[model samples]
Target: MDVELFKDGKRLDGRDVEDLRKPLKLEVGVLQKANGSAYMEWGKNKILAGVFGPKEAIPKHLANPERGVIRCIYTMSTFAGLEDHGRMGPNRRSIEISKVMREALENVVMLEKFPSTIIEVYVIVLQSEGGTRVSSLTAAAAALMDAGIPMKEPIAAVAAGKAGGKVILDLNKDEDNYGEADVPMAFTKSGDIVLFQMDGKLSKEELETAIDYGWKGTEKLFELQRKAFEEEYSEPLDKKLRMVE
Candidate 1:
């Protein structure tokens, strides 16, 4: 399939090269059984994340006496893709993503407060257009906050890439396949980098540009994350009932 990534300073999707897709929605406390849960929709991607534990670590040998262990599982649903359904269960790719996600979140969680315990985060992608990893990370952070996990601050993530030899913000599926480079990054609310990964080739200057665009994207996403939490907790029982009525 041929796609025109950039033309007249605008992407094929009619967005400016550095403009991100909007209406990024985040919903918290979506699961009743889980300690904390969040659902996120970014562009064409749909993700759900749940947080469990901070309870005693199972298989005690894995327990950290000095701090709690953070375990993350990132999985894509069989029907998540646009074409053929993805295979069910954890694959090598999923395992690697999970490991990276764990590392990204570990820096912010106050694990020392729950030594010998475990904090489990599960992210499931129900649909994907691109940037599922970053979207999942954002959702996971929201779920962690919903669970009242002690943390320095919530983290947000975004993807930036070079398409048509120009740096673009938040590449969608088409741009991702055709782009020369893709950089995914996660940062704390204070703008501290917690996760950074690059795929494809890029010059030093291009890579730096992509990272700068990623930071811009994350800043916007952080606003949505904060709003999600505020809305989740702000509604009074009576107000909620009134809305339902």
Candidate 2:
């Protein structure tokens, strides 16, 4: 952990403190059977998200007579972080992540449309380097849109932290591991902060600095989500030009 993470305001990977990783890719409607699906590759992280139901809420009790429910399950393949401490099945970390992810998604969905139903979202991490939650959130939002779910708008995810004694944006695995503080967040187009979580330690100023970076990064991330949807829904230049989404 003593290794220097930054040199002259640039990370070891040669990225500026506020820059997002390059070669990010996203695909929507990747699964045929699922109502909606998306695949996202961000940095070294590979994540897949699928949406199901809106049919009926299982067990009845989890359903609300007045509205629908959102059930999210976030899991990592055993090999995803196996080299670092991945578990065989759902553990405390996975359970907690699922809860928080569900809350973030619920903020943008119009649950009232499917009364007494459940919209199930599953996000699986096939690989990891860091920032998996944010990546998962980005993919899940696209999958929901692919499923034609009613939504207020799309949201994006970004993370920032204090690493190498400097506040940096979009942390990688190494920085997240060795950094003094980490904050992952989700944001809406209206600038509403839907998801926020902090790990490690930071002073008030450091926290604010990290969050500011996160907000800035989210602006671009949200566009990536939209781009995925547009590509998937866009018709070939032959028949109908483009579908209004």
The lDDT for every candidate, in the order shown, is 0.88, 0.88
Model 2, range 39-86, lDDT digits (tens) per residue?
Answer: 999988999999997888888888898889999999998889738654
Instruction: Give all TM-scores, in the order shown.
Output: 0.93, 0.92
Error of 1 at 205 (Å): 1.7
| lDDT for position 101 in model 1 | 92
Off by over 4 Å in 1: 237-245
Kindly list the per-residue Cα lDDT of model 1 for residues 26-118, writing each as its tens digit. Answer: 999888767889999988899999999888899899899999999899999999997875577898889999998999999999998999999
Candidate 1 lDDT trough over 10 residues, lowest sum: 236-245
Query: Which segments of model 2 are wrong by more than 4 Å?
Result: 82-88, 235-245
- Model 2 earns a TM-score of 0.92
For each of the candidates, give the backbone clash count. 0, 0
